[model samples]
Target: MSKTINIGLVPFSCVKLAEADFKDRAAVYVVLCMKDNNEWTVLDAGQSCEVNASADAHPRNAMWKTHCPAGNIWIGTYPMPTAGYSKADRFAMERKLRRQYKPPCGKR
Candidate 1:
């Protein structure tokens, strides 16, 4: 007999980077993910509303194809960093999450 490990519920958060009142806000944003019950490692990270907007086609979605009954995984964004944050900050956060999660899909 074979045992199956359900991916469990997908977890993610969304942040609206664009603000009509604040022109400085990021039009595109950042996203984070990690496997449930695992150490807090970012399973995947993405920046840019264009990429994020295509949530359904994300590569991470493939990871859950077999593991998750729903054939989907969490792919959401964190609140945009405050005014002090910059594009570099978003990259840095992606790097930090990649370091913590060591997610296979992250850039080398």
Candidate 2:
């Protein structure tokens, strides 16, 4: 079973799952990298209407890989269906998480 983590008080699906699980989902995503010491670092956070597409086209993907050459990168996602959360709501959540985590990449 996939573990869950809290990001800014919200529960998110664990990282390292198949990307197909998140395809076409509207959600907020947290990019993380696990180091050799088993410490996890927050790399970036963002919200997307289509999580898979957003991830595929992410501008910082290269940077993320550079930070974790061992390929320990993971993505945790909190689904926010369009019917339940407005785009503004998702953006607000993303901003809140970014502020709390202060991820190394993106507009931190």
Cα shift from native, residue 74, model 1 (Å): 1.2
RMSD of each: 10.1, 2.4
Candidate 1 residues 28-85, lDDT tens each?
A: 2222232455323234564542343445555555653444443224434443545656
lDDT score of model 1? 0.41
- C-alpha lDDT (0 to 100) for residue 2 of candidate 2: 62
Full-model lDDT, candidate 2: 0.78
lDDT of 1 at 76: 43
Task: Give all candidates' CA lDDT scores.
Answer: 0.41, 0.78
Candidate 2 structure quality by residue, lDDT tens digits, 52-108: 745644799888887767877778889899999988998999889888888878883
Error of 2 at 35 (Å): 3.3
Q: How close is every model to the real structure, measured as TM-score? A: 0.49, 0.82
